[model samples]
Each structure stands twice: as C-alpha cells, then as structure tokens.
Target: MDSGELEHPPAEELQVGPILLALADDNRRRVVAELYERSDGERLCASFDLPVSKSSRTRHWRVLREAGLVHQRSIGNGLYMRLRKDDLESRFPGLIQAVVGAP
Candidate 1:
C-alpha cells in the first residue's frame, strides 16, 4: 500500500476506559504533556528521550493512541506520534489546558 493511502484510526473509535487508565500514570502524563507543548504540526518520534524502557515506551504510546489522545504513524523504521488536540478539546473542554498547566 502506498504510504499516503494508509488510513489512521478515527478519534471517535478510541477506547476511553483504557486511555484514562494509561493517563493515570505519571510518566504517561508527562509524555502527553510534552506532545501538548508542541505546535499543531509537530510530531514526536518513538525514539525520543523517555525515562522508560523500549518495550514500556511502546506500551505507553500504544495506550495513548488507542485512547484517541494521539495519532501514530509508521515512518520508515520509526513511529511518529502527535497529539489529537482538536478531538480532545471538543470531547472535554479545557482538559488539555488544565493538564498542561498542572505542576
């Protein structure tokens, strides 16, 4: 399949329960915050500096992606992740802002 032709999962189909559970972790919350701080067009690679092991990092991102908090795509050998700001803001107003603001 052509890379441009691949479709990503819709935000509405995300599993809210699992997502909430994943976000309950401090490390996962930090990852979400980092993505939130980026510009709308920015993307974070899976190889970025994270405090967790490779397998655990994969789990964290998978939970976020499955929860609809982020969009993930395979680019060559790396997986790139981006925040689903619009969908999240619409679902829960000010939630992202509040989380980003929290100490």
Candidate 2:
C-alpha cells in the first residue's frame, strides 16, 4: 500500500472490449437493434421476441449493461431496457451505426 494515496475500485473502469464482446453476440445484436429502432427509445424486456430463452436474454442484457452499451431498470418482475446511444456514440463515433445500422 502506498502512503498518502487512495485506491480506486476496478469496477470504475469502462473497458471497450466488453462492449465489443457484447455486440459480438447475434441475439444481443437483435436486442440492441430493437432498442435502437424503438420510437420511444425504450422497451420492456418482455416486448422483445428474441430467439433465445429468457435466461439467455438475461445473460445478454447483463453483458450489454456491463459493457455500458445498454441501461437497464427493473420494474417488479420485468426489466426495462434502453440503448445507451449517446454514451456509446460519445465513446466511439459511428460504432453503433457500423454494427446496429447494417442489414
């Protein structure tokens, strides 16, 4: 331990690799796409029709949230998801477009 110094938690760091990894999954891609296309810019987790199971979706959401690619809010038994477009774009310009934009 260094004298007269404060140790910061590792969780404070936001790594880009996890964000890229979250986008690497096809199902996560779909979820991000839906959230991107939503007129309201938010959606209930139940509203998604992903091919993966609910548990799988939960995992995907966790990855996305952890990567700072998505923001999640819980409401009773469900989750509300919103794309972190501004944050993402601010971090890496045109990244979301390059991934989420392509057909």
Candidate 3:
C-alpha cells in the first residue's frame, strides 16, 4: 500500500548498493522473481512459502523494504507486500529486468 506503516526508504532515496546487497541472497531474489511474475504484482507476506524460518523471512522482508525494492503495509495481523515496480523503473530503468532476469 502507498501509506505503509512499516518504515522503508523512499523511492527517490533508493540506492544501488543496498538493492544489490538485498538481491544477492537467493531467497530474497526468489521473492522478487515471484512478485515480478504476477500480473497483479502484489501478495500477502504470509502467502510466500520461503524455505527459511519465520524470523529469517521477516529479515528478508526488511532487507527488501529497506532497499526500496518492495513496499509493505500491515493489514490486521498480516503484512501485504508488493514490488515497487513503477518506482524502480523510474529510478533505475531495466534494473529489475536485469536483476530478476525476467523475460
């Protein structure tokens, strides 16, 4: 959601270093790839079936959010996440396609 409760960097403030660092992890990359593949391009955080523990999953979400690769909002007890596609595209054209290796 646009008005997210969680703290994350603004799209304009997104940096290559943090985004690359966050994407370096396979699990985090998987999350990005999955998000990119979806037409709607949004999903609940719990909807992802990552191999890591719940705590680790939480950490991954933080990394992605902090990197400005994703936006997250709390809905009741669950968190909803979506790729910052338009923002990313505006800030760094072709970056997502190059990183995600999407066709």
TM-score of each: 0.78, 0.80, 0.91
What are the per-residue Cα lDDT tens digits for candidate 3 across 1-103? 3554788788889998999999999999999999998898899999999989999999999999999999888889889999999999999999988988943
- The 0-to-1 C-alpha lDDT of every candidate, in the order given, reads 0.73, 0.76, 0.91
Q: Top model by lDDT, which number?
A: 3
Best-performing candidate as measured by TM-score: 3
The residue pairs in collision within model 2 are: none
| Clashes by residue pair, model 1 | none
Off by over 4 Å in 1: 1-9, 13-16
lDDT of 3: 0.91
Model 3 worst lDDT window (10 residues)? 1-10
- Candidate 3 deviant stretches above 4 angstroms: 1-4
